[model samples]
Target: MHPIAKSVPLRLLVLLSMLLAGCLAESEPVEVAGKCGPRDLTPECCLKQNPGQWEQCTGSTEMVETAKTAHSVATRVVAAGVTATVALQPRINSAEHRGAELAVDLLLRVDKAIAQCVRRAEREVNDYHFDGRSPSRELCQQLKVGEQTTWAAYLGLFKHEQAWPCLRKALDELLPKKNYLLHPRFRHDGQTGKWEFLDEQAVKKIVSEQGWKGLTGSIEPDIVILDEKGFIVHVYDLKFPCPETNVATWTRYKNETWKDWSQGDLYKTALGVTPKLVSPREGVVPETK
Candidate 1:
């Protein structure tokens, strides 16, 4: 009886330990939920069910595969825009073809510009999902700057008959909400310097709602971006663009044999233009600050 009493506590303690272990084994691991609006990322359930990502995932194969058709059109528009810029650069000074050149060049530039702008806009829209806000002015300005740079080389190069139409088409494709039903999609990758890919569904919606505005192709986008605190920024003054060199320069030590310069000869010419931003006050032109 004495032994039995003493053993009771020890046995009970062991039994309690076993019970606690069993309880822990039966319990599920915790999962903190993440969301994309009403949609949920639903932890391991979603991760396992979705395959890779909807873009590469196996379960939602149709959604991932839907984008294949749009790639060609996107690439073509980008290529055409770049070609127009290079061709227009030297022709700006030609007298015989001046009018036609400028007109064609400007239209092409506008086309490319708007295309870039739309692509950027689409990217911004995609990011909106993650950012929990519409595209910020900061993002727009950076995007606008890149778009503007890509087409400004031909802004005044020639008069383009199709310029206005191209610009309008480009703007129409963006700005307006297509579905307005689905949460606006968005993503951003600083490494790729590209916003997010516009899903096929979204792209199709835009096209069905607004027809294509293929480039000739190049564009000129007006940019007026303010900093986080609402102050305007001077991207030009803030950045020193590395000048393009078509030739190389050489230097020699007093008594040493001269080594071939890989950077080809180039010379510093007079400061052609010191670009400054001016707030627009007189109609279309901005006053220098």
Candidate 2:
């Protein structure tokens, strides 16, 4: 090789090394679930900090792998456009796999939460020997004094109370793992019957500072799954029907903006994805028109 040509590769290697070093130096320690580790350590640094203890590291392995993959793509970009695309193939595939895994995990968590809440409700009713009557006062001293006289009366309350919080608990745990948004906030446009997603912090700040308000009250979706590009891929709502046997259905909005529009219709129109109903008894069911 010519002297200059040989030196080019050596210089490129040094530049790449310097860039990698700079990245490592700039890496901030990742905090997960209130646990913090040594500052300025990447996942790779964590692995090196404690050999074979990567599982215990605070830095996410997924993040480090993505960073490495991105670096590979950057390096290959100078070689050939096709080479860069080829290098990015794995990352694309990985993202798809991650999304699939997230979907399954999310559904499983929802199912578990539903089962647990339903089981508790059932146990409470059985223990109290509920007579399925609307109680004004405690029928027996055994029954705790409440607005609802019998434990059976409380089942209706359970349907509402357990649905959000139970799913919230499950979804919150999964939020840090993937691109799942719990109770994603959106601004509603009544004139067009469209929803403008409020995901950007800057937009939210602008809204708050400017006192910007939606034409209609905001639509809070139960769960939203975003793709690698941050486009919403799926939407889900938890529905716990009081009877468990009764089919879950979306309620029509009585508000002036939504008028008679069913929630399912609004969600579909706004999100471009069919909203799914997850019930304790039914598992997963498609919204019926």
Which candidate should be chosen as best, given TM-score against the real structure? 2
Question: Per-prediction TM-score, please?
Answer: 0.21, 0.44
* lDDT, candidate 1, 1-289, per-residue tens: 3322222222222212222222111111111122222242322223334422434322444434543432332322222211111111111111222121114554344335544433333233233323423333343223111122111111111112112233335534532311111111222234873333233453344445643221101111122122223221211111101111111112211211112311011000011111222111111211132
Candidate 1 runs further than 4 Å off: 1-60, 71-74, 77-92, 100-289
Candidate maximizing lDDT: 2
- Which parts of model 2 have CA positions greater than 4 angstroms off? 1-176, 190-194, 199-215
Model 2 error, position 221 (Å): 1.9
lDDT, each prediction? 0.23, 0.44
Model 2 steric clash pairs: none
lDDT of 2 by residue, 1-289 (tens): 3322222222222222222222211111101111213562543334334533424543445433543443443332121111111111111112234333246766566556645654454434333334433232333212221121223222433333334334446555655534555445566555875556554453435445643332134565566766555566667765545445566677676656567877788777767677877655566666766
